[model samples]
Target chain A: MRGRGKKYWLEEIIFIGPAVLFFSLIVLIPFFIGMTYSFTTWNGVNDEITFVGFSNFLSIFKDEGFIDSFCFTAKFTVVSVTLSNIIGLSLAILLTRRLKISKPLRTVFFIPNVISGLLLGFIWQFIFTKGFGAIGSLTQIPFFKLSWLGTESTAFWALIIVTLWQTSGYLMVIYISGIINVPTELKEAAQIDGANHRQYFRHIMIPMIMPSVTVCLFLAISWAFKMFDLNYSLTKGGPYNSTKSIALDIYIEAFQINRYGTGAAKAFIFFVVVALITFIQVRITKRKEVEA
Target chain B: MIRILKNHRRIALEIVALLLALICLSPFYFVIVNSFKSYKEILIDPASLPVKWILDNYINTWKELRFPAVFANSLIITICSNLGIIIISSMAAYRLLRVKTKLNKAIFGIFVMAMVIPFQSIMIPLVRVMSSLNLNTSNIGLIICYFGFGVSFPVFLYHGFMKSIPISIEEAAIVDGCTSLGVFFKMVMPLLKPMTATVIILNTLWIWNDFLLPSLMLHSRELYTIPLAMNGFFAKYTKQWDLALAGLVLSIAPMIILFLSLQKNIINGIVSGSVKG
Candidate 1:
């Protein structure tokens, strides 16, 4: 019995050891270390570290750049989340209907999602700068002629546009699944009760798809809040750092400016905010989800 | 008469949806057509077809970006990371499911909580940790980092999946004198194909297109992945749209092909993955 117990332990170790080792070394340890680093005045280069307590956190409140980025990220998240979900839900509805070109259209919409954000940003950069210019000249449309990336407001909208273009298709897939799961009998019953298209959408379809709405909202919030790559390649937070996201700001702070302590502090706060928001959002949405 | 009217409305909606799809695809049109146009021709009329198709841009950007090398680097990292994630997470998940010990439960809880902590939170110290462990700037280091960060989600997926699998099969294998490892490799892993496919599809898309972690880890030109290389290329040739567009096209081509070929699986994978989460 003793020998058998030992053998079982050995088998367990063989199966579970590598994952624990990697996960601890990579994620678990660093997370704690980063929390420690957040309290120190470590410049990321020198060995000497000074423990500064919460002053690093305190200074972020006074830092205009940080505040600007916070506001920008908050606003960006709102606009992008609202627009992407709306567009995604609309596309989901359209594609779920029995249309001849549904599959092909779905493919086209989803193609953008497959491309890397870095590449999509670059592709749109050309469209904004060059292609827009040509179209503006030929058709003489004022909307296409604006300096899309060169201005602050337009640059902000440009980021939102690219994000919507890339992510709506992904959200559409989720919404489609949700819509499909809605019972046909319920829809027929609603139809017999003379619910108009709008009434059915509001009273029945929306409630039925609440689970997907929760998922999509959670995803959109996280994606928008933690946005980095697209912002990096698209605008680089250009036009006077007006479009900078919190993630990009943290990267620039630590790497570009070598303010590791400050960056770590900012990162800690950012993590807390993201966790709290997503947690609350999930809890709220999960309550609304129906069994069907 | 009312049924005819309803049919007409449906057709109208279909046409409208088709138009919207065309609008969605317009950017690709701009990218592909302009990729083949000369700098002067592109500037002249980007909306029109290329007056003279040019191979120069593709050839030049391919050389400049070292397309083959970076492409291979991205492929290697993604494949190794996915393989590591699948093997490590599945084994760990299987054990966690079967063991039901205090330590196992605590470890699983840690992983679940770890999912909520954003990458940014650890990234600063991660850089420090990586350098201390001599992991920074090497592809192996990057792959290892991916293994760590990628484990939580897959483990979660695999854990949920393994619960549904009966323990009788493994018990039968044990009764037949098979070792635990053999039972896992031969008996269990085969049963995990569907979840494994979902895990692979999700992780492949993420790691392949991931730029931030790789960007921070790999500093050398030789270590650049496709996205990193494209960023560097664009930085250098911001004005050289002719070459930049071609690079964009080349960089996106592999993923487009993969997605198209595995469209159904990929879609199903994403849907299931998201819904489960």
Candidate 2:
């Protein structure tokens, strides 16, 4: 029994050891150290570390830039999450119908998602600046004439628009799976019951797919909250930082401005906020999910 | 007449969907069309067909972006990282499922919890940690970081899938003189092909497109991946839309082709992966 136990232990270590080792070294250790750093005044490159308790956190609350970024991210999250889910759910409904071009259309919508966020931002940057300009002049459309990424409000909308374009298809896929999972028998029964399209959909399909809504909302919220690459290449959080996400703000703090301590504090705060929001969102949505 | 009306509505819906698809594709159309036009022509009318299809932009951007080198670097890193993730995570997941001890369960729980901790949260100290461990500036270092970061989701996926796999088969193999490693590689890994495909498609898309982590870890120009390279190129040639669009095309073409060819598997993989999640 002793020898057998030793062999079992050896096998377990041989198999599971690398994952635990890497996960600890990469995620666990750094995470704890980051928590420690949040309370100190250690510039990223320095040995002079002063333990200032909560000053980093205190200063972040007063920093107008940080507050603006927090509000911007919050507003961005709300608008983008709502729009993307609506668009995605609509697209999923449209494509899942008995249409001839549904497969190809699904491909078309999802193609943008395959492109990297950074590259997508760059592509849209050209579109907004040059492509939209040329289209605006040729068509003489005032709507297209506005400097899409040049002004504060329009830049905010531009970020939202690009995010929707990039992510709606992904959410569409999730919703498609959700919709398909709704039993055909239920639909047929509703049809026999003289139910109209909207009634059938509202009463049957919506409840059945609450699980998918949960998934899509979770994904969209996280993506919108943690937005960085798009912010970087699209507008560089620009037209005067009106569109900067908290992720970008933290990045700029640590790497760009070399404020590691305060950045760590902001990051910790960002993590907790994200965790709390997602946790609450998931809990609410999961409650509404029907097993059928 | 009623049937005709229903058919008419269905046709209208199909047309609407098609139009939307075209609108979705319009950006790609503009990029591809304008990429072939000169600067002045593109400025004149991005919507119009190019009068002359010029290869100059492609050639220039290719040379400037060092497309071949950066493309190779991205490929190597993606492939290596995916391979490491598959091996390490699958093995760990297998053991975690089979062993089922309090410590193993706790470790698995910690892995799952780490999923919610966004990269920005730990990135500051991660930089310091990497520097101390001499992992801050190489392709290998970046690959290791990916191994760490990528393990959680794949392990979670594998853990869920492995529950359905009957241990009787492995037990049978053990009785036939197969060692634990032998049973895993020979018996268990083969059964994991579907999950493996899902894992590969998901992770490849992520690690290939991932910019921030690679940017943070790889500071040297020569080590830059495609996204980083394109970002630098865009910043440099900010107004050179002609060459810039071409660079964008080149950067996205490989993944686009991969996606197009394997779109069925890719789509199915995404559906299964998310459904499981």
lDDT of 1 by residue, B136-180 (tens): 968999999999999988889989988989999899989999988
- lDDT tens digits, residue span A215-253, model 1: 999999999999998998889999899999999999999
State the local distance difference test value for candidate 1: 0.92
Per-candidate TM-score against the hidden true structure? 0.97, 0.98
lDDT of 2 by residue, A218-241 (tens): 889999999999999898889899
Instruction: Give the C-alpha miss distance for residue A243 in model 2, angstroms.
Output: 0.7
Whole-model lDDT values for every prediction = 0.92, 0.92
- Give the DockQ (C-alpha) for candidate 2: 0.84
- Which pairs clash in the backbone of model 1? none
lDDT of 2 by residue, B107-144 (tens): 89999888999999999999889889898878998998
| RMSD, candidate 1, Å | 1.6
Candidate 1 ranges with C-alpha deviation above 4 Å: A1-4
